[model samples]
Target: MSWSDRRHLLRVLVPGLLAASLSGCGFQPMLAPGSPGAALSGRVLVDAPTDRAAFDLVDRLEQRLGRAETPAYRLSYSINLREQGLGVTPEGATTRYNLDGSITYALREIGGDAIVASGRVESFTSWSATGSTLSTLGAEEDARQRLMQILADQIVTRLLAAAP
Candidate 1:
């Protein structure tokens, strides 16, 4: 090939290769049905209390997941609350807000015993906004709900998929 032609090809290929390598950083669903894992359905038992709102969210997930015939694989969960604050601002606006850290958990059968598979979702919002206190609560609740779904789906997928 001519020198100019070779240079042009190198220019195109170098950028194209770099772009493809960097594209994997985006979120991806790693586990799916029919993957290299168990081929069965099982029951999930969450350990969190049945009275809390987070537990209710998990109950919704259990209903939609239907049933599994794998002799009811035990599902367990735990919830821990955490508190933290952002650094003070330079303009003298100093305050720290609250965050609701809810962790969802599940388990699956191993060689002879069940192993825990868990995920956590943290919901936080600033309460200092003017007016609409209830609105802020609504927004925080929405975030929690979405986080629950995501955690549930991830745990289920991991439980079903074979260890990679």
Candidate 2:
């Protein structure tokens, strides 16, 4: 076969062969219908947010695992966040900060005491503080939002994997 023709054939055949192999190995998409992830979607109730960080985390969780109309599981969580100054000016001012956060969460049946899934997820984000007061505040808030989203995604992944 011509070089161009061989390359074109390989492009099509490779993907087809990969798909065939994946199916043979019993590989399934996590969010596909009837999968463990689908079973948890829209059936988990996240605890109410008590602060800005908690609010952001809960919001992302609900976005991923749809808000439950009739909750079968209650998700309770505690958030711990710490900020440490990273970059310091020659004089005494801080120019940058690192925000470290961790969350301990548990998923339990609404009417039962047994914990179905529980774990702690930790993540960090940084922001520059060498700007105007307003700009620094904005950067800090954005970092916090990003951190919460990351933590929430980790939680959802764990919950999906733990789903029966």
Candidate 3:
């Protein structure tokens, strides 16, 4: 068969196979409207953030898990953040730095105070320090925000995956 015909055939065949396999495996979206994740939504009380990055992290978590209305669980977290120089110039100047961040979180039952789930999530983001001081600071802040979002998403995914 010609290349175009082979490509078209593959396009049809791959999707059919994928669908068959997925259906058999019983894959379910973690955050579907009525899934287990939805049960935790609007029912988790997140701890008050201690800093800007922590605040951003909490904000993103709330965006994913939904804010606590009548809280059934309490989520407490601690964050560790560090910066490491990556790219260096011959003149002994660092041009890029990586912000490494990790968060350890726990979910506890509200009334009984029993721990239900806990885990740590980590990620890193890089920023260029070669720009002006203000621009560099802004870039670093933006990188921190990105890192927080990544970490928060990871935490939510873990929470969804864990048994209730």
Steric clashes per prediction: 4, 0, 0
Consecutive 10-residue window with the lowest summed lDDT within model 2: 31-40
**Which pairs clash in the backbone of model 3?**
none
Give me the candidate number with maximum TM-score: 2
RMSD of each: 7.4, 1.1, 2.2
Tens-place lDDT digits, model 3, residues 1-164: 89999999999999999989998997777766778877798898999998999899999999999999989999999999999999999999999999999999999999877889999999999999999999999999999999999999999988888847
Error of 1 at 45 (Å): 3.8
Write candidate 1's Cα lDDT for 1-164 as tens digits: 99999999999999988777776664333334644333334344444456555675566556545444444455667656554545457775534445555655646554335554545444443333223778656755665555556555655555555342
Residues 22-57, candidate 2, lDDT per residue (tens digit)? 999999988789888887888999999999999999
The best-first sequence of candidates by TM-score reads: 2, 3, 1
If both were scored by lDDT, which would come out higher, candidate 2 or candidate 3? 2
Q: Rate the local accuracy (lDDT) of all candidates.
A: 0.53, 0.96, 0.92
Evaluated at residue 147, the lDDT of candidate 2 is 100
Q: What TM-score does candidate 2 reach? A: 0.95
User: Against the true structure, what is each candidate's TM-score?
Assistant: 0.48, 0.95, 0.86
* Residue 59 accuracy (lDDT) in model 2: 98
- Strongest candidate by lDDT: 2
Per-residue error for 79 in candidate 3, Å, reads: 1.1
